[model samples]
Target chain A: MNLEILGYSFIQKGLIAGTAIAIICSLMGMFLVLRRYSLFGDALSHMAFGGISLGLFTGIYPLWTAFIVSVLGALGITKLRKSTKISGDAAIAVLLVSGLGIGVLLISATGGFKVDLFSFLFGSILLISTEDMLLILGISSGIIATLVALRKQLLHLTFDEEQAQVSGINTDKLNYVFVVLASITVITSMRLVGILLISALIVLPNITAIMFGKGFKKTIALSVSMSVISVVSGIILSYYLDLAPSGTIVMISVAMLVGTLLFKYVNVLGKSHVIQKLTSEA
Target chain B: MNVLEVSDVSIKYNGHLAVDKINFNVKEGDLLGIVGPNGAGKTTLFKAIIGLQNHSGKIKLFGYDEADYQPLLPLIGYVSQKVSFEPNFPATVSEVVSMGLIPEKKLRKGAVLLKNCGYSWNLLYKKVGKDSDKVLECLKTAGLESLKDRRIGDLSGGELQRVFIAKALVKDPVLLILDEPVTGVDADAQNKFYTVLRKINTENKITIVWSSHDLEAISKLANRVACMNRKLFFHGEKEEFFSNKELLKTYAESAMQMHMHDHN
Candidate 1:
């Protein structure tokens, strides 16, 4: 591909926006994986659709509306997890379905909407604007700053809530904060990957990182790197192949996960002899 | 003075009473053992004392009722029954130990708190940073110094239990509460763990309360025993409770059966 094709202002904005979303989602994905709340990402992404529809109905900025709605969904999930006997997965399912249902109703009520909902469903790189790129950057920076400030508390809480509480961490508050951050990341990433595929950006890279990374910090770094590679590659492939960016990105992430798994398997097989010898000695 | 006093405390879960009308007092240097069946209220009682569960009646820690003595939490160290840490959580054994020091906020500089807990400086340095000396001492005390750099998720069941103990001990708590501290450990590790507990209790004069299903082990280690099965079935000296055949039959029938089966 020529530099002009890649360097077009619109394409450049799309790439920047995609990169920012990739970083935020990957970093936040680590926490979601650790806390075993990966599905919460999916739930909030769907819930953001409702917020987007509501924003359209109210003539408000959909991004801000989506952010607020996602936060509300996050808070709802947190509250439901604590106050009810429902499992996290069950709660997520309920919230996801209800939000999607509300979103469909609201979108139907809007007559001759300018933006096609299908574009947001599978994502449209062509829709990237300067404003959207700036929003992505802002959300990315916010996630990084919040994670840094609460790194210690988050680490402790993720490991053991009872211990964290005993150690003077306000676990209840931190839980809300973590989920809220996750909601915001979902909203931001939805612009690039769409509601249907956003969670892949949040889950796939983190899972791949977990298989190979040594520790928490390394896992996060590796996840971000993998996300960046996948998103950038996916965008290029989408452009050349005339495919949806969302589908391409998710497929690439899945491929990377499979590659990482195979690599781990081969490494484990190579180390089996040493492990067997050690076990026999023991 | 009694460091902890509980009166008519009851805890319910989803309409089922896990602990009903339990009462006890813990004094300085006291080793109180709580024993019961799987569904018994032993663990629930510990949770209630730590303010992890809402319950009826009153719990006084350091002479203040639990409701009003939120500040007293810093003086108490708790080790839960289940060690369900995030498997991929990024924390070394030393960092896990330092979690116990959180309540203290600002630990005294160059203090031997970690040393007393059993971690050394070298192991601490390998885990987080130079400031992890206290954490290393805690690991050493818990007999996990060599594994200081190891992530918490990689630890064995027995090793993880000890890590929690080390975390608790690093606080130099006035009272230490452990829930089923040796549920999955081998017999040998269990004995060693009890020895460590006894040593800590004797040497530091720290009051200790631990729950276990092993009546024989409880008899050996605990100076006082509290039998809880949704309520206080019995609470007194270990020998006295053991010698009371009727009370032992009612309080620890399963443990007694296991004891007889072992002898046979």
Candidate 2:
């Protein structure tokens, strides 16, 4: 392992971008998983891809376009779900397929077929520019600040919407804000993790954290820790094995989830013994 | 003066009229029990009052229009039939109870309300306390003090129901609305639950409006009763409401036929 390579400019940028995406995605993922909106995150990521493709065809900044499109997609899905009997999963399925279809159509129509969409499908940490890095930092910090300020309201909405509303927490407005925040997270993470695989970063770390987390705040903290560990480890492994950084990062997250599940199983088994002993004594 | 007044309120769901032209007045400190069979629009009425559903006509709570009560929501506490909480939702009992205070206090000040609910400020400040004093107080009120530290998912159906009621009670609302609060619970638990509810009404002077299908429970517990089947059939003193021949006929017909078939 060349210790100096870790300090190189490109590697440093990749690490910062990777860490920022991990933090934001994982934090948002905690709420998403709790609310059973994991598929919404997946659908929004695909929508961002469609936006990116459109931006590519028009020769504009894909990030801005992707952010706007994903937010619109989130709003559209929410409205559709509310006004119709369509299940959330069904709605996401529709959005995902249509978004992918549009992306493919636009890419081919613009004669950008040879533009290597595979890079966006997987990811290329080496391609992250300083501008993209700054966007990631700004988004990550904004998300953290908003969450901290609205922690009480967010926690209320997440746990019980009706009760939260009865207690004067504007659940509808908060839900809209939550969806928009999720859109930002998906768009910000698209550079490091790619639109196709962005939700993996958003969901897997949070799911892993939940197994060991004692409460909502702790779950968020653990999720950020897990995300950072996975991204850094994945990037390091990718450097050594010559693999895609995003794939390696997702693989690391899956490993962490599996590890946490095993640890939880052992803990539960140990507690059952004590419970049995107490029951017998009683 | 009436604490709550609903006049000719109707609710339509996708072109179907769930509740139609219902009128009622709930006096201050009234323990109003709403009883009707399934699909009788009892829950819809509750939802309409809370602004969870759109309805025509008018509703007033504490002399203010329902529309104006958005800011006064903290004065009203509601427990719905749907208990839909995340099974592994991360929060201690005390933290969950403290959520009831979000309307009354800012994040930091809400911690003080949490302590007032019976949790120790010191223990709450720590990672997780062993069911704070405030949490235990709520549990004791709901008759689940022993299960304070247990996760909401780990509770039995009856205990979970009580926990929801406890959550509502911690807010100390002037008006408490419960939609089928005792459904799916054992007879003993139901009895105990009603006793707790009666004590809260009589001792603490909290106003309550609960919906239930148990006529006997309603008769025994309610000072006032409202009967509804898409429209208000009766809304007055429980004795007068139950004694009305037409109202009794509506409720008794099904039960009477079931009894006749059983005897045959």
CA lDDT, candidate 1, residue A38: 88
C-alpha positional error of residue A224 in candidate 2 after TM-score superposition, expressed in Å: 2.1
RMSD of 2: 5.9
For model 1, residues A1-282, the per-residue Cα lDDT tens digits are: 655658778778888889988998888888888888888888997888888888887889776887888898779878988997789789899879978887888888886345556666667765878887887798789888999888878887888888878766778999988888888888778778888988899899998988773666667788899999999988888888898888999999999999988998989897998899999999
- How would you encode candidate 2's per-residue C-alpha lDDT over A1-282 as one tens digit per residue? 766768788889999989988888888888888888887778988888888888888888776777778898888877787779789689889878877787888888878654446666677777888987887798899998998888878888888888887777777788889999989888778777777788888889888877764766677888899899999888888888898888899999999999889888999999999999999999
The 0-to-1 C-alpha lDDT of every candidate, in the order given, reads 0.79, 0.78
The residue ranges of model 2 lying beyond 4 angstroms of the native Cα positions read A1-4, A114-116, A265-282, B105-140, B144-146, B241-249, B254-264
lDDT string for model 2 (B1-264, tens) is: 577899989899868998989899887778999877667788878887877788899998766776555554565678887778988886655567666653324334434433444433222112323335555666678787766555566667776777777777775666889899878889988887888889878876778999988888888888999887787878889999877888788777754554466678
- Candidate 1 lands at a TM-score of 0.86
